[model samples]
Target chain A: MSVLIFAELDEGALKKSSLEAIYYGSKVAALTGTSTTAIVLGEGNADELAKAGRFGATKVLHASDAQLNEGNAMAYASVVAEAANQEGADVIVLAKSSLADSMAARLAGKLKAGLAANVIELPDVSSGFRVKRSIFTGKAFAFTELTAEKKILAIKKNTITPEETEATATVEAFKPALNDTDFAVKVTNVEKATGDILLPEADLVVSAGRGLKGPENWGIVEDLAKALHAATACSKPVSDLDWRPHHEHVGQTGIKISPNLYIACGISGAIQHLAGVNSSKVIVVINKDPEAPFFKSADYGIVGDVFEVLPRLTKAVQEL
Target chain B: MKILVCVTSVPDTITKITLTDNNTKLNKAGVQFITGPYDDYALSRAVELKEQLGGTVTVLNVGESDADPVIRKCLAIGADDAIRVNAEPTDAYFVAEQIAAIAKENSYDLILMGRESIDYNGGQVHGIVGEMLGLPSISPVMKLAVEGTTAKITREIEGGHEELEAGLPLVLGCQEPIAEWKIPNMRGIMSARTKPLKVVEATGKDTLTHITNYELPPARGACKMIPASEAETLIKLLRTEAKVI
Candidate 1:
């Protein structure tokens, strides 16, 4: 038995989240006394996938089918399930992104395996493969154990620390059993945003809210994010008001992010917004109002005008 | 275009979470429940699709009788009917099994749900259901349109989005920016009282995962106040102590 990991890719390179999954799967494989094999879907550099050996993958399964490049959860799940069965894997691991979560769920059902999602910690194999995960909008956590013969886990991005090692793993191309019907959904066009950082995988996040005053004043937020090499996020209201795209919204009604450090500028720390970001390791809030609710949850607080605070913060960061 | 929208009842987003006396269960004191926010988008979108295409929209939930009120709320939002699988959501896998069973029985042309429920935030149900029914599933969909037997969906990708076209019998995990949510009206609320809400025993397999205990996250440290004029000091603190820069 081995651990099968889905190594996610984008624009022909392994995504940062996949590295976390690889590290996580490798740890699980070590605990279970099994090897870790990575499956690469979509178009990506084969050499980079083989380099996943640094994170503990013993081998890489490269499915280079053009049809597999565009994601369809059912198709991806079917292929992964078949690969798991063929390799006699006891555990299947994936990132907890929307795409991975859907595929992991379906793969679990197809394999009739035990599945866990949004897992933050590696399981203790001695105690029936128990893992810890956040629930209730990061409000609580539960330590769960999978009892089925086959277990599947979706690891949250940035939660697991990726350790690097030196080992050259072999890469082999494996063709999954798929047909035209499996491609029920076909991709007609691909539209990608031009940016250096993806929000979900970002380690540092700089977010703005209505405190910026208006969309024209968003330069401070953007400049701060650029100086910090962070992704830019906004409050739900900002996104609702069309100041930012919906994907950039981070809150209870938006994307929940747990970056290493989250700097909030102008956001008042609404409870809904807190539900999404309270998981960040360190939180810094910049607001003119000392009574802003976000201050209660912040690891650091700056009671000042964002217009003045952000430029200074950005300058300071650039100096660093 | 018969659309099936699945909604899950979960703890309110702001509810203070606590473990029960047994540690294996959640504490219920003062906890309020509501329909998962993601599901609201899915339900509203399904209602919109039904209105545009002139089709029946049904809402499904996998929960106990306590979830009936939320199910009725879905009906009030214009779902023609409802189904409540009379079982505690054991886990994502089990819940997906229940949904898949219902979907197979009904043969819905389109299946819709939130990307993930707030309580568990598994984000696996749509994918699992699609796999079980051998149908296409697109998640984190930002835009969707129906034309004849095909669905034009704009899927949210990293940094950008991808547009795809799929036939009927597809699953979509609706996210934000899909559409504006609609509130239930008096007429719909009254009509919901008479809508059919069928409760069926769960046919899910034994739950493979078991929660050993619930734990709250470590308390955050006290906030350190940095003077607005002393921005340089704050930046130095971040670079040296915080080491985030």
Candidate 2:
């Protein structure tokens, strides 16, 4: 009866969400009177893997398989299940990353574990294991009880805070038996969007909507985001119009974000849009229409033309 | 090519989510149900592939009679036929099991669905079904083109996207940019009335997890409105008062 955390990496470093999952697993281990083990299924720095203990894991296992580095869900699931079995783990914890989304279900199916995904809080294990999670794309929440003997939790990002300690984990090499069929899906090419803060992990995000008018008017939004060192996002209509890439669209059907601060320019708050961003710590709406639905949900608001207000806000952040 | 596309009915995106039945169920009164927005992308792409590759496109749903209209909508949009597993899709695994059972009975070359259903937002069905059938499951697919038995796919990751190649008997969870949403034409709508709609009993009944309760997020406080000319002051407020930036 132990907790196993899958420590995912970004550029050979542990992702912030994965660190939080380590902490989350440790907390669950403490509650259940068990130890926590962190496993890196792919290539990762040995020194960085050892730091999993700082986030509360008791030990770290490095698979160090180059084939596992690419986002291959089937192969990843096989390795994770093997690691869990070897560690005698009944609880598997993972960050709700795209990688996790792709593999967690496969892992659950392989291990016959009950999975609670998009979990936002630690489980209440007083009786049956119940976990709170965001549902309906952040419009509502649900408390679900896992009834299976083994449990899998894919926790949402920016929800759990990671605490560090002075301890370093003992790192050991681990090899999991693999099946050839697991590598059927071949990753032919990898293209990473460069030079901008990744929206999912960005602390602050600056977004605009249709009111920006055209693609050329996006300079002001970019300027504001650059000044604040924030990621840029746009509404669904903007993406639908080809004014921005679909990846930059933030809405119920698009990328949902819960940053520390979210600034919206010239965007009326539709429920679809609000569903994605209502979880932000602070929301600022800048729209010409005072009656724009966004103001009702904003922490701070300004009724003004985006063309005028965005530059002023950019200058202010740059000055700060 | 025989493509099986799974879809579900969700509360309209604009519907204000409300709880009823002692907070254990969603309030359906006055709520309009529509095809899951993300699933539309999957259906459209599947239809496009069938047009290009000379194959049959079938729509599948794990739901009760309430989902018939939504499944019919898919047929109207160019799905040759439809199947509804007569059961409530109460859990992700349960739904996946039903899908896997159907896929086994009929060897679908490719299976597609939304990245996740809007209602549960589990995003787990494709992987689970893929594992159950020993097929490759790639999700949030933004671009997919098929040639012979191979599929050229691009999927969204955290920061960017990845291009991949997979043989048939693949499961993909699709999203936008795969293809534009196809609205039902008048001719298609007329023919949809005569399309084959098969209703099958659900094979999987056990749900590993159950929701104990539903909750609405806390309400927002009053907005602190700043004058248009004093937009910079809002930044100071964000720094000192909100302290987020």
Candidate 3:
């Protein structure tokens, strides 16, 4: 028995979420009495690929085809399925992301594997292989059992804590059979967000709603985000009004995030908004309304006006 | 272009999540259902494309009769027709198999769906269907435009976006900014009453997974109130007590 983990790369560097997956996979391998092997596709530095060992993989398989870097779901799934077969893996683990989820769907179909998406906890091997996952957009949880011979898990980001080791993985060159059909989706251009943290991957997030009034008042939110090196997000109304980009909206109808710290300013906690961020580890709500529904779900609360509270909070963060 | 857009009927986002039947099923007593928010984007884009490209848009749902009204809403929003696979949509693989079987029979020129259903949030059907049909799939597509037989797509990625091109007969999982959600006009709603709604039996029976139990997340303790005048202390608490920074 073996575990195969897909360590996806972003612009030639291993992603933090991928490292977390390797660590999570190693724990599963220990429970199953198997070894963990990490398969890395696309173009990446050899040294960076070897960091898989630092997170817990015993071996690293590097598939260096340039076409693998295109983010084609079908092609990536084919390569991952091939790696799983070659490694004789019974379980495949991956970090949850748009790219990973897309590939996992095809991987499940190709391998006939039982896939559990958005898995939040390690499987309970004490009984059957059961996994707990978030459902209803993180409003509830479901314990699901995989009934297939092969299994795939797409674990939610930031759910597991990773540990580093001094160990080194034995890197091996792996070349999966490829053809022109594998590159069916042709990538024309790539535009990467420069300098700003992406909300989905952020650890700390500063968010607001209509309470900030207009788009011009966003400087306060941005100031706090810059001080803490966090990402900026808004409630649905802010995005709907075009005060912020739709991508920056975090709510039931927008991007769902589980950042370690989520600071909401001037936003009333509508049930829809809470569904998107209720899973956040620590929530701080700053609202003038004392009866705001968001305060009930918050770890901390400040009853005050946004105009007065935000600048003070930004200064406090800067002082720190 | 013949477009197939798959949608899911989910409890409104404002509804509190509650499970029944010994915690194995969602309680539907008073819950109102709507098209999955992400799927609404896909349906809107499909309608827009059909208008610009001059084609028919058919919406499909893998659910029981409870989803018929939701599927009709799709038609009211300008879908040419509708299909509902008669099943409970228990597993992601099972749903994908049904969709793939239907797609094989129809041979749609383009397939679209939301990134994932809001209830299950699997986000897996599109690629699984594409794989089963031997077609390429792009997911969480934010922007899509078709010229001739080629589609220029911009998909969301971690930290940024990527622009790609692919031919027709492809599957795409769409999200926001692809198109605005379309509300049904009076004429559209009236015409939907007569639109063909096909009901089909599911061909797939093998479910790879099952929910063993359900759980609600633990309720948080009372919020520790911090005075606005002493906002700096909150940061200190975050640093020293929470240790997040």
Candidate 4:
């Protein structure tokens, strides 16, 4: 038996999260006594794809097709299902990133496989496939069992610590059938600023809320983010007031991020917002109110004005 | 144009979550329920689109009859009608099947819903329904503009947003700044009671995944208060103690 891991590429390169996923799949493959194979659909060369070996994959199937240039969930699922069939993979692993969850869901349906999304741990494949996941907005955990012949697990990013090994993978060419129906959504334009650390994948995050006052006062937050090479995020109210982009909003109703360090400036921690960010390994809060709810959940708390504390913290980080 | 919007009712954000029946079920007693905050944006956007583009917005819920107030709120926010599938949504795939069945039966040009419910936070239904119905799906769509038979959609990618063009018969999972949250006026509230609220029996299907138990995350320790003047110390701690910087 083989374990198939979907290794999505960004601009002809493997992403940090994808590498973590490969590492996770490799660990689980070891437990199951099965070899791990990575399936790359989009850009990247075979030599680069074989680098997945360091993360536990023994074989990399490169589906080098022009039609697979852009992401289409239906077509991606079709290719993944075909790859699973060709490799005789009983367990499929995918990263629970944007568009990947949808692709995994569709593949689960297409293959009649039991799907477990947001999986945080590897299953006991020695017996039945069982996994753990966060539920109730991170307030609770749930143990799930997949009963189907095939199991698809979309592992959450940053949930697993990656380990590099000496194993290298062999690259192979893969081709899957495609149809016009897969091209329903057409890409009109793709716009992304070249080199900014995205919030979803950042190791450190600096966030501000209404306490920052206005959009004009975002300089200190940006400076701190720049000094630490971290991503910037905001509370829901800040995004609602158009002080920041909605994509930067991290709350229950917005983007949920799990970073190594999350610094909140001038934001009172609400349960909704905490539900999104409480998963961070370390949280630091800066607020004038000592009784701010965010402080209760923070590892470190500073009761001070954000305008003063933010600039000073930025300067200190710069000195470091 | 006919637009279909899917909504899920969830416990209010402040509700203390507890599980019962050996941790297999959520204890619903005395818990306050509200329309999902993210979904409100979708329903409001659907109403806004219907007003601007001339379409009938229909709300669909794969939930039990207890979700009437939430469905009525969708109507109050300007959905022309609502449909409730009388089934407890057990899993994401089951809910997706219910939505796909409803969408297939109706001739909706556009399907809309929140990116994910705050409760389960699955974020899988939109794409699953779209794939089941053989339509394109765009998720966490932050910007949408409909003109003629095409809609321009913008969604956040890894670093920034990607602008795309999709024809009718598409599913869109919406989030904030796409449309502002709409409050129901007095007239709308009164009319909401008169709006069509159809309840249908469940069309059950095979479920592949099951949750066996539930447990809460470990509580975090107390915060270490730092004086405002110790900014450099805090940075040093972050580097050495936290090892985050």
Q: Best candidate per DockQ, number?
A: 2
lDDT of 1 by residue, A174-287 (tens): 888886776677788876667668898899999999988789999889998998889999999998899887778899877888899999999999888998898888899999
| Candidate 4: tens digits of C-alpha lDDT, residues B167-216 | 88789888877888999999999999999999998786778788888887
- Give the higher-DockQ candidate: 1 or 4: 1
- TM-scores of the candidates are 0.96, 0.97, 0.96, 0.96
Candidate 2: stretches off by over 4 Å: none
- Those runs of model 1 whose alpha carbons end farther than 4 Å from true positions after fitting are none
Error of 4 at B144 (Å): 2.2
If the candidates were sorted by their DockQ against the true structure, best first, what order would they fall in? 2, 3, 1, 4
Docking class of 2: medium
The per-residue C-alpha lDDT of model 1 at residue A251 equals 91
True-structure lDDT of candidate 2: 0.90
At residue A70, candidate 3 shows an lDDT of 65
The collision pairs in model 3 are: none
lDDT of 3 by residue, A275-309 (tens): 88998999999999999989999999999998898
Per-residue lDDT of A142 in model 2: 97
Question: Residue-pair clashes per candidate, as listed?
Answer: 0, 0, 0, 0
TM-score of chain B of 2: 0.98
Residue-level error in angstroms, candidate 3, position B189: 2.3
Badly placed stretches (over 4 Å) of model 3 are none
| DockQ of predictions, in order shown | 0.75, 0.79, 0.77, 0.68
**lDDT per model, in order?**
0.85, 0.90, 0.90, 0.86
Residue A257 CA displacement from its true place in model 1, Å: 1.5
